[model samples]
Target chain A: MYALIKAEIFKLFRQGKTYYAIGALFSIEAIILLSAYFQGTNIIDLLLENLKQRFYFEGTLLNGNLLVYLILNTLWFHLPLILMIVVSGMLTAEYKDRTLQTIMLQPVSKWKFILSKYIVAIVFTLLVVLALALSSFGLSYFFFGKGDLVVYLNGLNFFDASDAYYRLRWSFVSGALSMVFFSVASLTIAILFKEAAKTWIVSAFFLILSNILLKVDFGDNWFNALFFAKLNDTWQYFFYYQINWEQIHFNSLLSIGYSLLFMGAGIYWFHRKDIG
Target chain B: MLFSQVLLGNVFAQPVDPDLLKLKSRLDSIQSFTTQLTLSVDISFINMPVKKAQMMYTKGQKVKFSSGDFVMLPKRGLDFSLNSLLEYDFITVDRGMEMQDGKNCKVINIIPTDKRADFSIATVWMDTRLRRLVASEINTKKDGSYTVHFQYNQDQKVLPDKVTVNFEIEKIRIPINFMGKDTDIDRKKMRAAGSKTGAIYLTMSNYQIKTLL
Candidate 1:
C-alpha cells in the first residue's frame, strides 16, 4: 500500500496540471491582495459611513488579517472548482494515457491502487490550500501591516488583532477539509464517467448545486442530516462572537463522512472495472 | 423660589447665570491636560472590547486622541465641560433651584446668541458650591442630542473620575459587500429602529493637569 501511494505521488508531481493548479490559486491571491491594497480602506469606510458620524474611530482596520479573511471567502466556489478540475485529471489522465490498462496487468490489486489515488487527491488539495495560506498571509501583512479586524457578521463584530489571527487560522484549517472533500468527489466522478470533460462538468455542477442548496432552509431537519453540502461553511462559525464548538465538530465530521462515502464508491467501481 | 428668581431676574441680575459663569471660569483656567482613558461602548450594532487610549487637550485646540489599537468614542460626550455650548455668547434663564446629586443645584437653561452654535438649547444642573456640573443636556441642530452625568474624585475634583454619555443617532444602512449574506441582521429592527440611543462610559486616571489660574 505504501509503495502504491509513493508511485501515485510521483505521478502527481510529474503532471504539469498540478503546477497549473498551484498557479491558479496563487493568481487569485494576487488579485485579492492587490484589491485589498487599493480599495480595502474605501470598502471599510463605506461600511462604517453611518457610524462615523456619531463616533470617532481610532486606529486602522485594513490590515493583513483582513486580507487573509477576504481570501477565505473564495472557499465558497472558486477554490473548490479549481481543485476539482486538477485533482480529477489525476485519474482521467490514466484513462487517456492507457496507464490504467498497463497498471492492471501488474500483481497490484485495483482496490489498493484506487485508494492510493484518493490519498494523493487529499494531499494535493491540502498543498494548494497551504500555498494559498502562505502567500495571502505573508504578502498581506508585508504590504498592509497588522491591526484590528472589523467584520459585519452579527451586526458588525470588531475583533482585536490577536483574536482575528486566532479565528482566521482555525478557519483555514477547517476550510482545508472542505477543499479535500471536493477533490475526492472529483476523482469519484471521474471513475464513474471515465472521461475528463464529463468529470469536470459533473463536479462543477455538483459544486454549484451544493452552494445553492446551502442557502435554502427546507424547514426540515432531515435536509441538513442528509446533505453534507451546507457543512462546508463550518469555518464561518468561528467568526461568531460566541463560538459554537459543537456545530463545528458536527459539520467537520459530516464533511469527512461524505469524503469517505465518495472514496468508497470510487473503490467499489474500480475493483469491478474491466480494462482490456 | 421660582417667582423670586423671576422677579430678581429683571431687577438686579446680569444677562448670564452666575452659576454658568463660575463653572466656565473654573474650567477655563486649565491650559492643558493629558490622561489615560478607558472607554466601554453600549450600543446595539457595535460589539467591541474595552479600549484604552491616551487623551490630550489644550486650551483653544481640539482633543488629540490616540491609541495603539482601535477605539471608539462619542464625539458629543468626551468633553464633559461643554466648551462649545458655552464658548459663544449666551443668555441664561434660571429655572429656580432643584436638588441634584444631593446638592442644592441651580437649573439654568442657556440659549446661544451666536447662530454659529451647533446646539440650539443647552441645559445644565450645576452644584454652584463646588463649581462642578452635576448633569447636562445639549439639544443640537444636526447631531441629535446628548445627556451626560459626571462623577468626581475628592482629591482631583477638577476632572471627573467617570462620565456617562448618552446620545441618539439615526438608523443607517450598510453596503452589501460589508454585510455579507450570513450575518444575522434583522431587517425589521433596522427599518423600525428610529433614532437609537447608545452610551459610552469613560473613566480617566493618571492625570497630568496644568491649570493657568
Candidate 2:
C-alpha cells in the first residue's frame, strides 16, 4: 500500500499539469491577497463600527480574527474547484490518454490501483488546503499582527483563548476530511467518463448540485437521510463555539457516513466496471 | 400665618390663577439652558434583548442637538424644552374641564412636524399647578401600528434629579435552552425566564444645563 501510494504521489507531482494547477492556485491567492490588502482594512473598520453596537471585539484595529475571516471568505468557494481539478485528473486523465491500458498490463490489482488513486487524490487535496490555510495565517499575521481571535457564532461572539484554538483545530481536521470525501466523489465521476470533457462536466455538475441541494430543506427525515444535503453546514458545527457537543458529534458522524458510503460505492462500481 | 402666603401655597399646589401665572413666568424667565443628557434607546427591531448606550448632547432649538456620533434637528423650529408643554406647542385651554393638577389644565394635541420624530403625538396633561411645569403623558407611535405608553415622573421635575420614564411593549419570547457551549451554568436552572424585551426605562439624572450669553 505504501509503495503504491508513493508511486502515485510521484506520478502526480512529476507531471507538468500539477505544477500548472499550483501556479493557478498561487495566482488566485496573490490576486485575493492584493485585493484584501487594499479593501479589507476599510471593510474591517465598518464591521468594527457595526459590531461594537452588539459584541465586545476588543483588540487593536487589525486583529487575527479579521485576518482569519478574510482567508476563509476567499478559499471557501475556490478550494472546491481546485480539488475537483486535481482529483478528476488523477484517474481519468490516464484513461483519457490511454495510459491506464498500459498501466493495467503491468502486474497490479485493480483494487490496489483504485486505492492508490484515492490516496493520491486525498494527499494532493490536503496539501493545497493546508498550504492555503498556512499561507493565509502567515499573511494575516504579517499584515494584521496577532491578537485575540474572535469569531461570531450563534448570535454571540467568542473571544476566549481556549475556545478559539479548539474551534480552529477541529474545523481544520473536519474540513480536510470533508474535502477528501469530495475528492472521492470527483474521482468516481471522472472514472465513469472515459473522456476528459465528460469528466470535467460531471465533477462540475455534482459541485453545483451539492450547493443547490444544501439550500432546499427536505422535511422528511427518511429522504434527508439519503442525501448529503448541506454538508458545509454540517462542517460548520465544528467551527461554531457554542454548539451542543453531543448533537455536533452526531452530525459529524453523519457527514463521515456520507463520505464513506460514496467512496465505498465508487470503489465497488469501478472494480466491477470493465475498461472496455 | 399670613393669608397671602397660605393662598399662594394653595394656588401653587392646585395651580389656580396665581399659581398658574407663577409657573408660566418661571418657564419664561429662562430663555435657554444647555444640558448634557443621556438617552437610552429600546426598540423592538434592535433584535437584542437589551440595548443600552450613553449619548451626550448640547440642545438648543433651531434645536442644535449634537451627540457623539449623531446630530438631529427636532422639528417645530427647535426652541423646545420637554420640561414645558407650552414651549413645545403642546398646550391648549379646555375651558369646560378644569386642569387637575390645578393652575388651569389644558387638553391639547401636539403633532411633531419631524417625520423621523420618535413619538407620533404627545397629548399633554398640563397644569400651571406648581413652581415648574406640571403633569403630562407622552404617547409615542410604534411601528406605525402600535402605540407605546411613556408615563413621566410628574412629582420630580427639575434638572439633575432623575425622572423615571415607564414603558410597556410587546413581550419578546426566546427559547430557554441554549444549544451552544456552557459558558454560564446558571442558565440551565431556569425553565424559561421571560421579561419585557421591548420596555426600557430612561433615567435622566445629572444635567449640565448652561445658559448662553
Candidate 3:
C-alpha cells in the first residue's frame, strides 16, 4: 500500500496541473483578502454595525473563524470545478495517454493500483484544502493584522481566540473530509466515462445534483437533518464557538455517513470496472 | 433643560415641588408606556455626505420605526419594512442625572433586550420643568455615536417641529469601487455600515400627531 501510494504521489507531482489548483486557490484568496481590506464597507460590516449600536462585539476579524468563512465563501461554488480540474484527470490520464496497459503488465494486483490512486487522490484533496485554509489565514492576517477571533452565529456572539481556533480547526477537518468525498465521487464519475468531456459532464452533473438535492426543504426537520443539504449547517454546528452539540449531533453524523458512503462507492466502482 | 432660554428660573425657583415628584413618580411608575414617537436617524460616519432617515416609532410588545417607505425590523434579521421598523424588545433603566444643553436633567438609559438588538445604549435627558425628554445620546455598540436634541411641544402629547441629531464620525480611506443601488454611491454603504466617521443633523419642519391606544 505504501509503495503504491508513493508511486501515485510521484505520478501526480510529475504532472504540472496539480500545482495549478494550488495556485488558483491562493490567487482567489489573495483577491478576496484584498477586497475585504479595501472595500471600505460591505453587507457583513453593515449587519454587524447595526447590531453594535445595541451591543458589544467581543472578538477581532483577524482570527480563524473569519478565515474559515472566507475559505468557505471562496471555495463554496468553485470546489467541484477544482476537483474536476485536478482529480478527473488522475486515472483518466493513464488510460488516455495509453499508460494503463503498461501498469496492467506489472506484477502488482489491479486492486492495489486502483487503491493507490484513490489514496493519493484523498491525500491530494486534503492537502489542497489545508492550503486553502492556510492561504486564507495568511492573506487575511497579512492585511488585517492577527488578532482574537470573532464570529456571529444564529444571532449569538462568542469570544476567546483559543476556543475559536479549535472550532475552526475541526471545521476545516470536517470540511476537508467532505471535499475528499466529493473529489472521490468526481473521480468515480471520471472513471466511468472514458472520454474527458463525458467525464467532466458526469462529474459536474452529480455535483450540481447533490447541491440541488440539499436545497429541497421538505418541511420535515428530521428529513432535512438526514439530507446532505445541511452540510454547511453541520460544519457550523461542529465549529461554532458555543455549539449545542446535542441538538445537531445527528446531522453531523449524517454528513460523515454521506461522505464515507460516497468515498466507498467510488473505490468499489473504480476497482471492479474494466477498461476497453 | 426644559426651558433653557426662559426668562425666569421659576421652573426650579419654586423649590423642588412635591407635585413635581408625584409627576415624576407617575411617569416612572408607568414602567413601559406605548406611544408613537417620531424620530430621525442621522448617520454621520462618512465623508462623501451625511445621511438621515425620518421615521415614526410605535411602542407595544414591539417597537416599530417607520421611515419614508422603509421599515426595519431590527430584532429579526435584516428585514425591510415599508410601514414600520420593529424592535422586539427594549429595556430602560434610570441612570441617574446629567447636565446637558446648559441645564440639569435626569438621564435614562435604554437598551434592547434581544441579543441581536442593534442599539447599544440610548441616554435620554429629561427636563424636570417640562416633564419630557429633552435630548438623547444614542451610541451604537459597533460604530459611531449620535446625539438627538429634542424640543417638545407644550401638549406633552407630541414632539416639537425642529429636531436635531448631532454625529461624531471617523474617516476611512479605501481603494476600490463598491457596488450598490447606485454605481457612483460610495457613502451610502458606509452610512449603512456605520463606518465610524461623520455626523448627521436632522431637522423636522412639520408636526402631525395621531393618537392610537
* TM-score on alpha carbons, each prediction: 0.92, 0.57, 0.56
lDDT of 3 by residue, B1-213 (tens): 343212112243223333233333333333232223233333332111122234343322233343322111222111111001113244456767788877688876656555675567666677766665567666666545666666545546334444565654433323232111111243445445543432333444443334332
Measured by lDDT, the strongest candidate is 1
Arranged by DockQ with the best first, the candidates are 1, 2, 3
RMSD of 2: 10.8
Q: What fraction of the true Cα-Cα contacts (under 8 Å, chains A to B) does candidate 2 also have?
A: 0.00
Runs of candidate 2 exceeding 4 Å displacement: A41-62, A74-76, A147-162, A238-241, B1-213
RMSD list, candidates in order: 4.2, 10.8, 15.9
Q: In candidate 1, what are the lDDT values of residues B88-119, reduced to their tens digit?
A: 65678898889876778789998877788788
Q: Give model 3 RMSD, 1 decimal.
A: 15.9
Q: What DockQ does candidate 1 score?
A: 0.58
Between candidates 2 and 3, the one scoring higher on lDDT is: 3
Give the Å shift of residue B100 in candidate 1. 4.8
Model-by-model DockQ, in order: 0.58, 0.04, 0.04
Residue range A63-113, candidate 2, lDDT tens digits: 444455545543344667667877788877788778788878888788888
B171 Cα displacement, candidate 3 (Å): 27
Off by over 4 Å in 1: A220-222, B1-14, B99-104, B177-179, B183-189, B192-195
In model 3 chain B, which range of ten residues has the least summed lDDT?
A: B77-86
